[model samples]
Target: MKIAFVGKGGSGKTTLSSLFIRHLAAHEAPVVAVDADINQHLGAALGLDEAEAAALPAMGAQLPLIKEYLRGSNPRITSADTMIKTTPPGEGSQLLRIREDNPVYEACARTVRLDGGDIRLMATGPFTENDLGVACYHSKVGAVELCLNHLVDGPDEYVVVDMTAGSDSFASGMFTRFDMTFLVAEPTRKGVSVYRQYKEYARDFGVTLKVVGNKVLGQDDVDFLREEVGDDLLVTVGQSPWVRAMEKGRPARFDELEAENHLSLQTLRNAAEESYGNRDWERYTRQMVHFHLKNAESWGNAKTGADLAAQVDPAFVLGERSAVPQPS
Candidate 1:
């Protein structure tokens, strides 16, 4: 199952992401967490010190190598240099499984030990001085999008992503990649505004978006979120001294979580468990091909000086384990 945590700035999406990751890891679920946020704070929330977090290789810095590895021996993909971020997986392209022994994970992710067990994490990377005038954050996030596009996971496996705040993810098809997206909304109007934007944007795509109300102080706060979002409000995390202490670098445990907070995490876990059986490979494959063609037409062909549409093998299906002959 794949999960995305998103929200308005300071809505504690990163904190909630870490909590969910911790809960999954502690329960012995195989999972990987990706810090796709430009703010880049998921590591600190996961208990990594500044130096250790900085040491983990940035996925953006390694785009070329990742593209090279993921292209594999696909006949349609003649060269890695021709591979754009939206390149969809075909018959011969390499596909990723969660925590599989692979060079991509070795180079881009690091293991962080926690009270339960260690969890693997990867980051899209920080906006550097070089990118100040020259780049868009989308370029950095493309690594994650491509990874998700090519990844094939079993129901027991999990991928948790901490998305960039607000609707910034709408700039690309990244928001549509998750199996379920938890929008961490506070009781404030500013919080629900993001939810409204996301719900409206994703309504047409059939993305499963549920709300996790954070910082709820009382029934009034909970009522405010319910009144605003209705049944979409899956669960709420109330004020938590334990979370504050942990985020402050003091030790904390999942068992020590406030009753409501712990129940909220369980609700999320239950949702994930239920969704594994509902995997939609056809929709996933459609999305990959859709974005690939869109990018190819938009700028990929001009940038690569070749008809990038050749990268898609019409006879090849993403989830089916079979091969098709290369077209003449």
Candidate 2:
């Protein structure tokens, strides 16, 4: 399953994302953690020391190769610049598998060894001085989305992304790329407001969103979220003293987190595990086409639209209702 964690800047979504990745690793599951946020803190949150995290390359920095691989040998793709987020995989496009043998994996992924299991980390680099006025953070995020769109993960595997905070995710269709999105919200008006905005926009895309309340101090805080989000509220995580200690430079593993924090992590794991099922391939492909056509009309060429349309898997668009299987 592919899961994304998004919310307000201080909502603790990054911390939660790291914790979930650690949880999957502890269970010996195959997982790749993508730090799609501009701040790029998921590495440190995953227990990588400053130096180790700094040494890792960002996927955004490898955009040239990424685009080249994705374009493959497709004759219709004349230049990498024409490759948009909704660009479908074509004849020569490289298929990404979580295993290290995949060229895409070799090009961008870094394995971080942890006590439980080693997890691969892929980052989207922060916007640099050169990008000033020349590019937007959305461009960096778009690289991550493009990589994900080309990836095929096993049922027991996961791709956990830490998305940019707040409504910025709506800047691109990246918000619709996940099987599930965990919106980590603080028990405050502003936090709940972001949730409302996300739900309203994502409703039409068939994206499943669940709320994870963070930094809840008391029943009052919990009640506020319950009232605002209702049953969409899945887990409420109180401020973790263990996390605070770690922030202070104390060493701590995920399993050693405070009891409350550990339980909250388990709740998230259960939800993810239970979420495993069949994907609606027809619906997914239709949505991709919708976004691709919309993008083509706005910024892409007519041929780009035609090429993308032709790339949609026949079984998916032909109304066969067959399962569009991925690598297991």
Candidate 3:
């Protein structure tokens, strides 16, 4: 299962992301946590040792190798072998060597961290390259997806991608890749507005989403969000001073935490487990294609009309289902 987190900046994506790795690791589920945000923080939140962080290069480093292998560089360097080799260095290397067909494999190499449990956690640094364009995002994300596709062989493995805030290319792109996307927002008008915009964009891409309201403080804040979004509140991460301290790299007592504490993280993770099922990307793409292909004309009319609804409703003169048909 591939799970992704998206929210406005400072909306606690990294905190929840770290918690996800910890939760999965505790339960012995192999996880690859990718930090897709430009400014990375998942490492620090997870209490990663400097040495461990330094060893794992961004998955982007393998793009050139991927191109080479695709052009028939070597039969032994399959997608699976390449991902296994490129993972955050640790004992997974031993398993590589045991699979004799892998020519590049070496025994006992530090490639991935296996905490003597069923789970192994690997994290990718954030994407900060600024020459923004669809091609650049696609290239980087393509590599990340390639790596994930290689590591996660079946439904047993899970990937947690911590995405940057706002309705930007990276955030939108993250939605396209994951089976399900979680949109996070704070208890402010700005946060709600941002998620709403993100929701609109996600709809354009036909993304299946669930919203999370983080940093919920009082009844008023909760009521406002409930009114704006609706009663299907996925999870509300309570506002906690300790959470802020954690962001600043300080440790605090759990008792000091408030309602906007990690409780939402627990709720979010639970929803993820419940919502997760066997996913087929091909099926998702087909459904999306149908949506756009079916609504192509109405969307175009909406663009030209004064009111967007005028392009869809039968009551509107310019609508696709209107009484009179207009010229092209």
Best by TM-score: 1
lDDT string for model 2 (290-314, tens) is: 7766777777666444444444444
Q: Which regions of candidate 2 fall more than 4 Å away from where they truly are?
A: 75-81, 302-328
Query: How accurate locally is residue 216 in candidate 1, as Cα lDDT from 0 to 100?
Result: 87
lDDT of 3: 0.52
Off by over 4 Å in 3: 49-55, 67-139, 148-153, 170-174, 204-206, 241-245, 248-263, 278-281, 285-328
Candidates in order, TM-scores: namely: 0.96, 0.90, 0.63
Tens digits of per-residue lDDT for model 1, 67-182: 98888888999999998888988877888878566778988988888767888899999999999989999999999998988887767788999999999989888787888899
Candidate 3 lDDT over 249-317, as tens digits, reads 674544344544445556766676665564554444343233323333444224433222221212111
Clash number for model 2? Answer: 0
What global local distance difference test value does model 1 have? 0.87
Better of 1 and 3 by lDDT: 1
Distance from true position, residue 183, model 3, in Å? 1.5
**Ten residues in a row with the worst lDDT in model 2?**
316-325
